[model samples]
Target: MSTDPRLFIDAPLSASAAIPLAREDAHYLINVMRRGEGDVVRVFNGRDGEWSAVIAHASRKGAGLTVADQTRPQQGVPDLWLMFAPVRRSKTELIVEKATELGAAVIAPVVTERTQSDRIKFERLQAITKEAAEQTERLDLPELRTSEKLAAVLDNWPDDRLLIFCDESGDEADAAWGGARGRGQPMAAALAGAGDRPAAILIGPEGGFSPAERDRLRSLQHVVPVTLGPRILRAETAAIAALTIWQSTCGDWR
Candidate 1:
């Protein structure tokens, strides 16, 4: 059988040194996994990379580990970002988890005019992303940005980065309008030319972008509005779908 999946705990780790894992983590390893002394596990911090560790001690309160050896080099993710309006709590968690799995370099919540939810618990969301990355064997965790106004985000948009806005309204047009203008070429071809330049996929709120918001986004020079087919998709679904498309087109999917 494959080795047990490693976890991302808060404790610091050094090669050949012992570190005490948190009480919560200890319960998971000792109680949940039923692991005991001398059992091997893996651990990683976003900074130190991945390491093989052995369970030095386990108790109901916590667990301890001895860092053994570095198992892999730190991984580098693509320069893609997932910018979306925050949905419900469950869906928000889903987005964070799936975005990490899809290799999003950053997770940004953009507050649009029609946004329903304004409050976001950053700590909880970060934990979800970290867990997802550890389970998926991703050495890097996507940087989670605080919620920013849509207009503010547009104003601060980097000149070199391309914004792929998923525009549902573009489907009715006979010809490609907005970002779809140059989409005649295959996605792979378009992405190949993008090089290391940063790219972002913009997903709107549940109610979708307002007409004024659409107009403003379309007017931006860096924004490239693309269609996610003819169907109207929910905000969370659209985020995953758009990210998947981008990854397949220009990311590490190959």
Candidate 2:
């Protein structure tokens, strides 16, 4: 593990470039981390490769770092997206952070019929992803799409990409647990046949999707419904589990 601080510098990074640190980052390095002039750190922009940098100037007012040679070439995550209904603020942030660490290329909040928290703080979530990416050594941050209704997203979903629906509930009222039979194939089995197409995982809210929402999702040809397991998982757990399964089965982890 590297002890040097890693930062996501949004500027164009190149050899011999002197990039000024953002105020919060400056405070973190100078005041928080107690780093000073000539101290080395690592930096990366989504477009440029990772680079080693030396703090050229550090002060309470600001700090700057001079870019050194590239350390690693730019690499992108596999084309996998995570679309989950937002839960409580803390849990929602956890989903975003963990999704970034797990290498989701895009993070989208989808509002379902039973979604508890329809609103999202995009700026705050973006910060969480940036920090997560920095800590995880991801070459780039996941693209955080604005929250959208599940219906609209489904309507606009591209044909080339597949949507994996983490369906935990079904519409059969008389059936056990409202229809465990509604549970699609086990996630690993469904993903094993998903081929190499780009994919997204959709996790519903705590209350799960409304019957209409479930029906609509099931109606989609490109949607592959799957179950996490026999046990019911919390919204956050479901998101993490779904992402993990997808990555292991159909993404870069393979």
Candidate No. with top lDDT: 2
Q: lDDT by residue for model 2 over 149-174, one digit each (tens)?
A: 99999989999899899877644421
**Which regions of candidate 2 are displaced past 4 Å?**
170-182
lDDT of 1 by residue, 132-158 (tens): 887788877889999999999998889
- Looking at candidate 2, the ten consecutive residues that score lowest on lDDT are 172-181
* Model 1 accuracy (lDDT, Cα): 0.80
Give the Cα lDDT of each candidate: 0.80, 0.89
Candidate 2 at 223: error in angstroms? 0.7
RMSD to the true structure for each prediction, in A, is: 3.0, 2.0
lDDT, residue 27, model 2: 87
TM-score of each: 0.88, 0.95
Candidate closest to the true structure, highest TM-score: 2
Distance from true location, Cα of 92 in model 2, Å: 0.2
